[model samples]
Target chain A: MTETPAKPPARARIPLGQRETVAGYLFLLPNMIGFLIFTAFAVVASAAISLTSWDLLSDPEFVGFQNYIELLTDDPLFRTVLWNTFYFTFVSVPVSTALALGLALMFNTGLRAIPLFRAMYFLPVITATVVVALIWRWFFNPDFGILNYVLYELGVDSPPNWLATRTWAMPSVIILSVWKQVGYNMVIFLAGLQAIPTTLYEAASIDGAGRWQRFRNITLPLLTPTTFFVLVISIIGSLQVFDAVLVLTDGGPANATRTIVYHIWEEAFVFLEMGYAAAVAWILFIMVFLVTLLQWKLQKRWVHYEA
Target chain B: MTAHGMNRRRFVLTTAAAGGAAATVANDASASSGAVSSRFHAPAMIGQAQTTLTWAVPGNPDEIAVYESLAEEFMSANPDIAVTLDSEAADFEKFVTLVAAGTPPDIGFATLYNWPSFAERGIFLALDDYIAQDSYDLEDFYEQIITPYRYNGDTFGEGELYGLPKEIAIRAMYFNMDIFEAAGITEMPTPDDVWDWDRFIEMTQQTTIEEGGRTRQYGYVQDVRWTFWQIWAWSAGGDPVDNLYKPTMSTLDNPAVLEGYQVFTDFVTSLGTAPPAAVTADQGHSEMFAAGLAASYNNGRWMVPLFRESDFRWDVMPMPMKTQRAQTLSGSMFGICNGTDNPDEAWRFLSYVVGAEGQTRMTELGLLLPSRKSVAESDLFLNSAPPTNNRIFLDELEFAKPLPLTPIYPELEKVINDQTDLVLIGEKTAAEAVAEMHTQFNALLQGA
Candidate 1:
């Protein structure tokens, strides 16, 4: 042992860059493993389970594409829910996007306490969907609600029974969703508005352009890329709407507010039809995918990258 | 019966009902005597070989505290078996996750909402063997209350026993005397007071008041819950389904059911009496009633503790009757898990919780209508009333029907509501809604 001690150990060399990369990966190893298991693996498992009949309590029985077929052809609720999801997307995306843009323009005037105003506008986006829904639910109450009281004062004989009728239920849920979502979109639009070159506005004003004309000619064109991005994301987000409908109407007043995701939850948790829920989830994924793809395809015609 | 049991903690010593299932409870009869029955309660095992039981029940903090105190009392009596509370056990998703992971609590909970279906899925252990071995006195519980827990593969109440009912939620019409007097009605409901549907409607109309296109006072405020709606269908002499358990057809199209559905739907859409469904979306019917906005409210005993703080004088009354009287029964129960490694020990805990001692403790809080007849009829409940007619809860149990429970109940609930919502919105007649319900219900039933 004493003779062997004379021979010192040889040091293995590793490049600093490679060592850093290895250390970085090691730091991420735990989270990466977690993500792979919980997100990636679960997603794949869900896709496979979509082909089986599982009740969560029993062993899954493989049924090939039967779940998909049932949902597409035989399940009437599926069609109504899918149509409801699209209706929500088409209506909510534009309304929230336009409202967000309007807020961005109003707040971009270098007003005092602009951050405070922006924060106030974005408050609902960060608030719990359930808490806001409960408060809005009070506002929409047909009996003793402020909304009805105002309608009565305005001499409208009858205010629509919000969240209680086939026609008004979805709109009530839509209004709440728009209220919740507009804040987030407004922040993004505010960023887009600030990024526009101030010189363009100055030059246009010097050319005797009025405020409206300046916005129409210079600001609108320059903001098209941002608008396109907002549209794509808002459309995708709108298609996946769940929490508002859940807390507000619970896909009810005759499934009027029932969206694709609420239906998936009902199938999986409430009905214990996990396989059917997975199939519904997959269908929702496809719809969101196709709609986003279409939006991306259409963006090239209107999206402007120039300042 | 033992004379010494009279001095035991179970103060109610009413003679047990005469029935085939009547039994001689050992420890209960000799509770104060120097003896122990359960293995863990044996004198030799005092502070020795121990087993801990996890009891999962869904409850708010206050309710869980009630359970926890009882659990503490149980553990002190049986030092060898420590009982722990898992309040999260009440959530269905969490319950499923626990079961899936093979870590289900020794004791589990189920409601009429999912009890039968969960039993069918084998999530719980059968209790007949345990009951027979222990000779447990189930005759103390109402037959109808216990019937719902007896599942025979295809139907409940026909085969093997599966649970010990904790309590039943049987709702009755609670009338506010102040509103009734203001409406110029001097009649208060007697215990035997059973109003016909027409009489009930007349009273409701009289109670309703409107000012400036707004309802100043609602005649009656009933929850739009499908379970409540089903009472209208049943009390109108409509079966709603050929079979109560796992019904394969919808009798919602029956003329009587359609009649019940129309009258109830019209209460909101056309009558201008009850507020629109949106009122409930924003505020519960009970809250509205409690706030003195409604003359009468329909609810369960659980509301008593909350409603006691109300300013108005209110009393529970018998529900309106049509061709027959009907009320809805929804209940929760506890049973041993099938995966439990210690079934005997689990049974010891379950039998104790559902025993007379435990139910009496829970009911003392004015939050339960115990399945045990003695507890329900005792001074603890029947006499602890501003209702003055608290017996209505007890009497109405005679006419109560269990909420329709099928393996596909959640779907059936949606199927019924989807169509009924149309009726409530004036978009469809009861007949049309029933037609739609028939198609959807049959499909779900056959699929299940």
Candidate 2:
């Protein structure tokens, strides 16, 4: 055995760099495989599809930028949809973010049954969007809706039809989005709030700073990072809003509630214009990327970091 | 970042898992059943195996029973071929979507009104070749039933034909005798005795009365544009859909149609003879007539079933026509799937559905008036009566006109419905609404 060991077979040794590379690749295997199979492939396929006319059957025919051009200029509903989506994103994002931050601050303060309150507030975030949209639809119904009934009790001469009136539809949709979104963002901001040291508030108190002054000086500045994150995420989420709109309004009552995503859906599924829908999808992606980039650029002014 | 990242990761993981689970389910189901697994699956072999064909139909429970019985007979006659009947009451949209998704049954029921749309989308198999080769008895079908299925000027009737009429329904006035009696009305309105706007209003008023300070009854409700258009257009002495595929609402400026619309709208909005806007589609006129809440409702021969179970006596007369004998024709068509793996079997099933024996069986079930002219008029159909007035279908069939055949009819329908609703709701004046409709309709037509 010793003689055999002494004459042991030549040990094969891999180069350190090569070994390290192999290990790194192995570690990244799952994610790389996933990206290749899912994201990258999907993007390429969708882009290719964007140039082709497909009606879910038969072979697709390449139509170049015909779909894009139609969506931009010739499509009658595009401008209306873009404007509605933009309006929804702008109004709902800021209002929802503010409400979320306010709620986070309240919950961050040591309160009894804080976890229970947090869970209750986060309920809507966990509930299905369809169920939420349905509940909101019923609440907004003109004749017998609880909202209108409450308005009636308040002696308002004529409460506006929450989901019906063209003027009220976008606002109602925005209200619903804000309600559904506030919970998730609130939790995120609460985490950020808890992470901030209590010493800052104490230091402000030691300096005889009022509650409003402390909040304006310390809380707002310190919470800026979380606020920026929430703002970006919420705005991006709001822009692509589709499910609720599909279930509730169907972009109806004179196409008042038609969002860009809804238009894309109609083009793809209803009108069987897959190429046009793909183009719309790409356009939406670009718009979201640009908006997020703009937010990132803007964030430098207000976002604060410990480092 | 940690909490949010964790939540995001969990969500992604769960979504992936759910998708995997769904795929697993699909795989398992298909693995067990060859037809489901392969989607475009070929028929399975069991040595010297027999083949089974499937028919997809949209109908009420009674029609499903008729289909099942027909399938039994078909399979019994053709011992080598088995037949499966699948029935769903889901609308044509669902059926079309399912077919487009590539899971179409061997044979299915579709409406002639929607035949062009289906044909354009490639949901249907053209049976011209089969018809020419087989020398099928194409003359047995009613001329009206065959017209809608013909594209490119070729008849493909009954043998995996793109579509053949399963039933025929013609527009008529379905009057509730109970409501008429309550209104103290002795004579019912007939096609020949057309009511002027004033007389129509007076009749609606006399028929519509408030009992105990709540409006318990309605005299009439304005029908939707499709049904109402025929009456108004024929009254105005114009066709509903012109040869140019334009809505004859432009022709509504004609005194007769204008008067017809005025009378109709007044009966609903002005005379309080119709239900509110909320239930107008499903529960307005026809449902009111069924519930003994309306003296008269304008519908079609198709809706006699509402009175089948009703305690009150009911009857259908020819819809009051203004100029010519007018009735809007609407009916379902039986067609084979274009992408069916087994066209031979599908054609066999189609032949049975559109053939004399199949039509007689369908008639006997009282689900519909058969498309075969002979079957429709046969002692078989005339004698098999649930309401005891099966002859009304034949009477109305003579005046029936198939709705306009256009691929863009759905979009046109939306536009027309919107305009009609606006005019009815008094949101827009009839002239303004019709003008708007013309503009919108022309735009849609051009786009299509």
Predicted model with the maximum lDDT: 1
Among the numbered candidates, top TM-score falls to: 1
lDDT of 1 by residue, A16-130 (tens): 6887898899999999999999999989988999999988888889999999999989887888998898888889989999999999999998768998999999999997676
Instruction: Write one digit per residue (lDDT tens) for candidate 1, span B1-448.
Output: 1111111101111111111111222222223111222433554354488787777755433465567667767777777776766655545766876886678988998777777668878999999888899898999998887888888888867788788888888888888999999888898878897998888888889999987666789998987666677778888887767787656777766888877777787788788687777887666677788888888888788778767889999988898888888988788888898888889989998999988877787777777788998898898888887777889988888888875667777778777777877877778887898888878777777777
Please give, as one word, the docking class of candidate 1: acceptable
Q: How well does chain A score by TM in each candidate?
A: 0.91, 0.92
| Per-residue lDDT of A242 in model 1 | 87
Q: Candidate 2 clashing pairs? A: none
DockQ of 1: 0.34
For every candidate, what share of the true interface contacts is present? 0.74, 0.03
Off by over 4 Å in 1: A1-12, A203-209, A305-307, B1-50, B245-249
lDDT of 2 by residue, B153-256 (tens): 22222233467677675655667766777778788654345455456556667887675434656676545555566565565465534442223323334455
Name model 2 segments beyond 4 Å from true: A1-42, A52-61, A99-137, A161-164, A179-182, A186-211, B1-46, B49-109, B120-123, B128-143, B153-161, B167-235, B244-327, B353-398, B417-427, B439-448
Residue pairs that clash (backbone atoms under 3 angstroms), model 1: none
Assess the local accuracy of residue A83 in candidate 1 as a C-alpha lDDT between 0 and 100: 86
